[model samples]
Target: MTRRSASTGRWTGSSRCCPLKTRPVCRSQNPRSSNEPLAQGSPASCTAAVPGRERKSRQAGRPDVTKLLVLGAGGQVGWELVRSLQPLGEVVACDRRRADLSEPATLGALVADVKPAVVVNAAAYTAVDRAEQEFDLAQTVNGVAPGILAQAARSAGALFVHYSTDYVFDGSGHEPRKESAPVAPVNAYGRSKRAGEERVAAAGGDWLVLRTSWVYAARGQNFVRTMLRLAAERESLRVVDDQVGAPTSARLIADASAQLIRQALDERSRGSFGSELLHLCAAGETSWHGFAAAILEGWRELAGADSLKLRELAAIPTRDYPTPAARPLNSRLDCTRLEERYDLRLPDWRAGLMLVLAELARKD
Candidate 1:
């Protein structure tokens, strides 16, 4: 498929090359409007910007050890980022309380005040089903806020890193979607996220948008948590079998973000850093039923003979379980661009799932 550059209005096919970065792009090229009302959140209460010491640190050619700002420090990926980003710099982590994406205007101000050398936006409006009802709020938070953050990063001369979803695709074919593939989001949430991607690209900054799928963590309310809770309370469980994607762990995503951030910082030192979108998810794919089964089997082994009363597991089609929002049947993503550029590759889904199971067992 031919990849069109939203920045340069040029086309490139199948090559690992980037479009020429001439100047800051305009707003009309972006389909999403930034004038939407902000999502619900208070303005930033940070009085002083980042300390002067950090500014000096940037000039001394040691920006890696400078201030690294991360938005959404409370979610699964955000929680892991606190620890993962420490190696790169003095991690100034902000949850919704500190830096809320819903309050879009505040984000730009907060970013400007903080003046971070690197900005990683892990925060997003991820309520897939609820997004159908709150389309405006979702678009405001997921779409406009990212563009605000990206522009702030540009003004502060910081590299922007954002996360996206496989939902950007319609999920028609069994093959993994590449970065160059045409996007056709089926649900409101997907449309909002895709809008965020466009806005970020149009902002014309040094940015990296990592698109992942089926994300879960040891903490937070994810698929694994839901399955475990249901298994303990019910006699059986029914999971959809038609949908397929890699179950990417939050820890893995955090680690990969750190790696990519480090590389971006290193490139900046050489007076150059380019922006590109890439896929970053666990290797291989499986249906939701298969993922649930693996989680249960792993938990059973860890619990010895005293496992949950999960007597039976049933696989159902997507049509059998209607939801407020439609889910893509295929969430698989091709990560060749990521692997080739960063010399990085994720481990298989099973390996990461085992680690998560082990962590959960330890907590118990």
Candidate 2:
């Protein structure tokens, strides 16, 4: 089954990668086993076979298949994960309906049932401002649930992957924050996410926590889409310029995750796998006001200046635009560790924004 993306108008496979009701268990025909040694040479060469490893599956005959369970399949990053993880293994993608993170107790049963080789949790309570009033709900979903999921994955001998945010930091310094930096979340949402990270770590499992900043995608409610919508409605826009960070796309995050998964699986088989936290985001940075300008600029280049009502874009400091939640000024996350470890070179924020804008333009 397939569904059309509202933003891009492109047909994409359904969230469920395999029919769990009919098949019960889905497996890919990828010939490479977890125990197989990675190809020699650069990391690029080592992972080059990941997307096409299934070509020789028929010849190899019933090769080992990795079953991956992805939660929050309806989300932007989760949606992309369903597509990107297909080549790596048999994916059992579950939206909130199938796996509700709000009810953490139920997750163990689901994990036990699927018995996946890997468990990726992309679900979270992301309403930053609303979380101020509903901190309990946010904590239940973001904080408690991930720990439960991680523990379940540990019991099942499955590698657990979870996503965090730069909001975990207090945003005091101007420098890009390393993974080892002290965490001091400034808002309720950040506190909840920080709790989730600590819980996942305490669960004692082979887990990976990827901390990212300003995530957006073509097919979701994101900064890029929101900017486009506002441009179409308002003649002039006032955006906050104080907060700065890289606007990482969901597609990039999913693709990089698949690559990391492939490497981790190989290492796991060789008894060299270890749990770690890493920051992943696009290269470079920009303020929200700058990001808004870029979005409008990209839209104008793609759809023409006459297509938007946005004329003047004004920049204001955080003090000028106050909210219920206190936002961190510095949201930049250092990706040097992720880059060196995975041998991956992340694209610039502008490059990613342009690609999303182009996708949105295709729908028009």
Candidate 3:
């Protein structure tokens, strides 16, 4: 365990491979425009700015320690961000309730007060289906908040770390979408997220947008929990099989984000630039049915004598699965950029699921 400072915002870590340095980034506050209109897509130069951070990360040198402030302390990603940012420096985790993202002035004030070395925004409008009807709220939270946050991070000389979704890309490509691929989101949720990405890039902030898919954790309400509950209650459970993607664990993403933030902050400490968009998810993929099967398998193996059977899972097509928002049939993110840059390895979906499953079972 790393020991963190109570007042100076300093931290002491015992990690040999990564004993991060800690310090405040800057003291300036980010300002906002009075228009209060919604920010839109990334332009040519901005959108295309996702050059590999790995390109600049080759020269290895110990970066100074930095203080980090994480927005959205309540969400799944935010929860883990709190754990991951420990070794880096003093971490101040906040959410909409703790601080206001809609009130740009408040956000700027918070940044100035925090004086963090980095800001990781894990907060967002993740209500995929509900986002269609709740466009305004979604846009406000996911789209507007990010731009505001990015500006704040940049103002504080903080490297903003962010998380995005696979929905940003309209499911039209055969291969997994790359960081540079053109995005044409079909739903309001996707549109809002894409808009957020664009705004971050356009604002010219030192940032990294990690677009992930099917994120789940034992603590939150996710697909795995839903399936397990349904399987036990109903005789048969219908799951979409046509839509395919990776089922990433919150733990995995948190760890990866930690590693990436260390590198990014290291660069910032040495006064170097870093990459913006990086895909961090598990390896391989699976349909909803496949995921259900794995969950059921976990249930049976570890589930108390009262768990459901394999016969309960009914494979269904995407058309039958109706929701307020449309999901991507191909959410396979081309992780080559991440793999090559971080030179990191990700376990398969099943492996991550198993870990989550075990955690869930322990609780159940």
Best by lDDT: 2
Q: Residues 272-329, candidate 3: write the lDDT tens digits.
A: 7665798877889888678778888877888764677435567777676565566778
lDDT of 2 by residue, 22-112 (tens): 1121111111231322121211111111232332222222235576888767677888888899888777777655676767888888887
Lowest summed lDDT across 10 adjacent residues in model 1 is found at: 11-20
**Candidate models: Cα lDDT each:** 0.74, 0.74, 0.66
lDDT of 1 by residue, 2-54 (tens): 11121101100000110001111111111123243323333344322223233
In model 2, which regions exceed 4 Å deviation? Answer: 1-63
The lDDT of model 3 is 0.66
* Worst-scoring 10-residue span by lDDT in model 3: 11-20
In TM-score terms, candidate 1 sits at 0.85
> TM-score for each prediction?
0.85, 0.83, 0.80
- Candidate 2, backbone clash total: 0
By TM-score: ranked, best first: 1, 2, 3
Q: How high is the lDDT of residue 275 in model 2? A: 93
